[model samples]
Target: MFTLFRKEINGYLSSLVAYITIGVFLLVMGLFLWVFPESSILDYGYATMEGLFNTAPYIFMFMIPALTMRTLSEEQKDGTFELLATRPLTDWQIVWGKYFACLLIVLLALLPTLIYYYAVYKLGATEGNIDTGAVIGSYIGLFLLGGAFVAIGLFASSVTKNQIIAFAIGVFLCFFTFIGFDSLSQLLSFRTIDSFIASLGINEHYQSVSRGVLDTRDLVYFLSFIGAFLVVTKTVLGGRKW
Candidate 1:
């Protein structure tokens, strides 16, 4: 598992994928937090990073897809997936290895945002009375959200040898998981069922956990979502060998 993890990390870092994903994340965050007019951090009038958090999901939508699109698709395209399957590694190990590689890139991209935190801390009127709890919760929520998306993206990549198709499928799946439920709930016939439908979405749980309250249900939901998709991806890959 460790060997596979290291190989995936090295493969991503050695290529332009890691660099481009991180670069795009940083660039978009910078533009929204510093340069954008209506929603700029400076215009928000608060020392908190509400603006950053609000813009991060959209940035993540693109960045996570890019990070995950090529993981399995490239291996399949190069005919190395069969070689990987024949190795001593289990399917779970390969999935996790690739997952960790993408997660590492996401975490690395997030590290630079701490500078924004420090800046906001210094800019606070009372020597930084910022809501550290909320920020930490937001970070946790973001990580879980990324994990779930990466799982979905990996599943999509596992289904195809073409990275572009994988990317498209990933984007659609991610978008649906993120916002589709909420949209559908609005159109539901029964008001009583609306809440249940909306709660099925990633955004609903994400919003709940991002408010500095770590609900066990939300955490479980994300973990289960990721685990389900990963299990499906493993099953799909296993089918190839049979």
Candidate 2:
């Protein structure tokens, strides 16, 4: 498992995927936070990071798919997945190794965003006037969100040998888990249980955490959400034999 994890990390670095992923994420986030007037923090005249937290998930919907699209699909397509299976590693080890490698890539992409936080922290009417609690909570929520998305993407890749197909499936699944339930809950037909339905999606818990309150329920939801997808991914990966 460790060897596979290291190989996956090395594969991403040698292929420049990690650098490009980080660069593209920062570029798009910078534009939304600075250049785009509508979403720009400068135009808000406040020391808040509402735009960053709100905008990141949508960007991640696309960006994370692009990053994880090849994690397993490329291996399957190139006939390397067979090599991986013949090794001593178990199915769970393979799934986790790939999952962690992809998650670390996402963490690298998010690290530089702290500069934005610091800038907002200083740009306030008073230095460090920002909502420190909220900022920290939002960051935590975003990381959990990324972890869930990576699991979803890995599952998507596991079921397909084509990277493009994997990406499409990943994006759709991410959208469905993240916001599709919330949208479905808003339907007139579902009005009676709308709130309950909304609770099934990631956005509800994500927003709750973003509000600077770390509810154990929200933490449990994220953990369960991520774990469910990863377990399913392992199931899918193991199913290749039968």
- What value does the lDDT take at residue 86 in candidate 2? 85
> 88-178, model 2: which lDDT tens digit per residue?
9999999989999999999999999999998888888889888999999999999999998998999999899999999999999999999
lDDT of 1 by residue, 111-203 (tens): 998998898898877778799999999999988998899899899999998999998999999999999999999999898799999999999
Q: Which stretches of candidate 2 lie over 4 Å from their true place?
A: 189-192
Once model 2 is optimally superposed onto the true structure by TM-score, how far is the C-alpha of residue 25 displaced, in angstroms?
Answer: 0.4
For model 1, the run of ten residues with the poorest summed lDDT: 38-47
Score every model by TM-score. 0.97, 0.97
- List the global CA lDDT of all models: 0.88, 0.92
